[model samples]
Target: MSESAAPGALEQVRTFLNTWWVPNDTRAPEDRLPALLADPAAWQADLPAFAFPGREDAPGMAELRAALRAALGEARPVALGPWLARHPLRAELSADPDRPPLALVPEDGTAGGTILAAVAEAVRAGQWARLKACPDCSWVFYDHSRNGSRRWCVMNPGGSESRGCGSIAKVKAYRERRRITS
Candidate 1:
């Protein structure tokens, strides 16, 4: 709940979803596990509130990561009507023209509710295919590209970057094609 809560909501959701790499391979590194297992209290304290009020069963890191992975694995367009109906969202309409008034207040145990709302909001804003999980790294990212055709996570997405297997896989395909042609 910082000074920029409203505008920062979507970014906060994006940041939260990017927490773990839901490994696509057996050798997947645990970028999110060590810290979470090491210290639960501190980890929860560090989570972003986004634009929503907090709720009970706020979900441990593992659960939250699982939901994100599950959604990506479904690999389909978000149909938020049913999801929204399941959760009791507390929000108010806005009178201001330049601002969005969808402030979500969850009653309880709707840890994944924020994400669904964010997805709905993004889709409502015409960002139809924003969420993407890299097939190689298993890292989730928002596709900010104009055409929404981004297919891989960043090669280096902050400290201690992943091997960018998505890019590596592309190169492997190219090499195989050359071998066949040669």
Candidate 2:
């Protein structure tokens, strides 16, 4: 995994989910998947962890992205069950006794199946529940806080950059409080 990514295969899920547009971010305010679908090489470059879907699989990928976004936004894993059912995983036995016995692999070569498999693996690892969409900007992020109580995406954890929905939400709440007080 790269330095920017979450640990283990959860990074794939995080990256996939974060492809959705955020309104106030410096990045383009548009869903990135469309451009990626138009150019498979760019998609592969960005998401090297998963299989790049063929042009024919673009619709399935889009549907999967929507389903994933909805599931994360609502904090409901059940929302993904039907979409995930279309991309079943195959269990591969592991050799080491200390590790998990079976590893879930994508049943097909499409990006949707690979990401869905990653989601299943993340769920099994107890990390899927931590992946959430920021209520303020709808940006998907993995909450790595110790208590798992993080509610917004931090723009600058160490004052590195002022670009997160958390900062914007705090400002809005502060303004609202001031207005009420006045």
Candidate 3:
């Protein structure tokens, strides 16, 4: 993993959940989830590769995305408990017994076959949270924080911190106010 990459298994899962699954201005809104599941390579060119320890194919990627979409379509929150109940990653994280403590498996399926497995374990263990789609944008992300108060998409440049859709109206209000003052 790069110096700036997520530090551990949980962090790695958090990063992937938050960053990889979302659509931004560059990628069309409708293409985000499908592109990530069916053809990760399409987005790979733009993103820093995820590095775990033992690398193998992860079936969970597609399964989880499908499940998430189904839940979202139904207007239900994707809960981590139900997700892990269906898909488990324990065996994968333990692929390399000789590797260093907290050694992560690279995500490109090159290392051995442990990265996705570890991610599964983390999700099962509740180390990660079920991410909700942004109210403004349909992007999904893990709420890693304690409060679970996150609501906006990080993939968006302004994200939750800014006014987002509310900004356009705010700008119009300011312009109208200035006109009146003039």
The clash numbers for all candidates, in the given order, read 0, 1, 14
Of candidate 3, the 10-residue stretch with the lowest lDDT total is 47-56
Residue-level lDDT tens digits of model 1 in 1-182 = 42112233555555565566555445556565445445656445545453322333343445655554566523344544455566656665778786576654544445466665565555556543466677776666666667767777754333344556556888889999999999
Which of 2 and 3 is ahead in TM-score? 2
- Assess each prediction's global lDDT (C-alpha) against the native: 0.55, 0.73, 0.43
Q: Candidate 2 — which residues are off by over 4 angstroms?
A: 1-4, 23-28, 73-76, 96-101, 155-162
Q: Return the clash pairs for model 2, or none.
A: 155-164
Candidate 2 lDDT by residue in tens digits, 45-119: 888988778766678887888888777634347877786677778898998996578888877767788888878
Q: Which ten residues in a row have the lowest lDDT in candidate 2?
A: 155-164
Per-candidate Cα RMSD to the true structure, in Å, reads 5.9, 3.1, 8.5
Instruction: Flag the better candidate by TM-score, 1 or 3.
Output: 1
Give the Å error, residue 151, model 1.
0.5
The better-scoring model by lDDT among 2 and 3 is 2
Q: RMSD (Cα, Å) of candidate 3?
A: 8.5
